[model samples]
Target: MRILSAPLLPLLVTFIPPHVTRAQTTSVVLPFRRTFSLSVSASPIILSLPAQNEPYWLSVALCGAILPYPRFFVSNESDVTLPGPGGVQGSQTGEELNLDEGLITYRAQMSSGGALAIWPSSGAGANWTIDVAAIQDDFPTHRRLSQLPLLGDTSATRALIFSPPFFTRETQEPIFPNYTFQDAIPSVPPIPSSAEPNTTLLLFPTANANATVWLTNSACALTSKLGGVMTTTATRTVYRDSSGWRRQWFVDGLSASTNYTAYVIENNAQVSGPSYLRTKSDSFPCPLAHSIPYCPEVSYAVPLPAPPGSATSYTDDNIPQDIKA
Candidate 1:
């Protein structure tokens, strides 16, 4: 089941306000609103909502007070009934929000109550506050907007933090003929190697070398007959280098705190060792208190006491936890 997941609807997500009480009433400016208290047991938990009379764009706000970095997937899918393994993918209709950062808007007009699926990218069960609203008016397109200024305070302060609006494209070229032993010699040889940051190795036979490589969280089984097919459902091809004669291959573009196994195949037969490598884990961005991977820098937020008759207030917090150094 190779699923090429693509965004179905135009979606935009805003960042959550710091330490806003879930019960705090919004100044009845938006048209429709709904709130729910949930504890996510496993990933891809689908929450159903009652449908509406007319088509309207929906805004989703999530608050994870206890989780370090909670990830969410919101879908108006007609049939997302159960939680699936791995993160949400191949959705015909849905949008994934940033981990821990809690705001998303989707252009949806629910004929009936739609479904929103939520999940954690890297944490155990934790408490979550979910808010959804149907914008009564239709906007031309989808994009993230800052929180509406409903609290009428002229002296209130606001600071905007921006991340790149586009995905970072990384292109990895094959590292060939490094100081590693060659494979495809019809014998299992000791491929002497040393660890390098964000890199791995592959060995191949120069004759039948049209090879492919895969990276996985766990070890993947290998077969002697090289499979000609490059695509597989179970694994993602991080690096694909053809022509086995390239002898020694070095693989790069790895992340820290991940265990990766590299498998090389040519024409349905395993040509190189299913070499395993584990990258060193980097330190968490937050203080030592909430140091786990899932913990966002939520504790660092200090609400500024607003002066009476002030319209705006500021909260001092560290950088976004997702923005690593």
Candidate 2:
């Protein structure tokens, strides 16, 4: 008997599987979003300061858009001083000044409501003028509420004054630093980290509040062996991301899911945070975008089992008997 060999046919289609990444024990996280609610009107300027209020901090973002690292400061006085080394001699990549453009708004504690001016840290000469324009304001606000007498506390306002994109303009003048005001409390908060569990970040309450920030276990609860007291750097850390100041501190070690609190030992003590935060218990696996966590990345066909004693799981029995084998 003789047997004939057949030729194999080529298939027309092919399938490619999607890429899959293995899960890890650690993950990355981002800080909470900050709100810019501070708003004012320019139509009718409020020249006089509020008669019955406390001095507050003011934050300015110089050349906020153009400069690689815009100039900034948070001060309580009308004439504030910019932080970090002054002059072109020793400056970082983003510290260059472009006086003609940029913005300076009371975006922070601007609620105090007063005029603003600033000088470089290097010298006290040529204080720049910060022109803040508001859109709709009362026809005029009496310096004192008593002046409203017969009018009985009434005011008028207009809309669509300036074109759009209202901002602060800074123009330099050859004058010495002038004007002073009482100091006010700042309101910076602590930010959480995603890396090692033994770290904390402090956005100083005041620009110059370079004090120690202790990390202690919750006062209400017993201390966890995983961590103890932690402190910030001796000097202010110039964070590029902000014209404002920021710093990082190391903890002895942080225990997962443990409660802790942070506070400044000096400078500005008003912010006690009576505030506490709890550490996460597990290290989350950070994946790119696993919106559908259970979706499969690869697909395969079910392998048909051969007869109980067959050597392989492959068979052609499903083929019609009329077909060639």
Best by lDDT: 1
Model 2 lDDT per residue over 65-178, tens place: 211222332323322222212332312122222232232223222333332222222211222222222222231110101111010010011000001111222323445576
TM-score against native, each model: 0.28, 0.18
Give the clash total for candidate 2.
4
Q: Please estimate how well model 1 matches the true structure, expressed as its whole-model Cα lDDT.
A: 0.33
Off by over 4 Å in 2: 1-228, 231-236, 240-243, 268-272, 285-325
Candidate 1 minimal-lDDT segment of 10 residues: 148-157
lDDT for every model?
0.33, 0.22
TM-score of 1: 0.28
The per-prediction CA RMSD against the true structure, in angstroms, equals 27.2, 34.2
Q: Which is the leading candidate under TM-score?
A: 1
Separate clash counts for every candidate: 23, 4
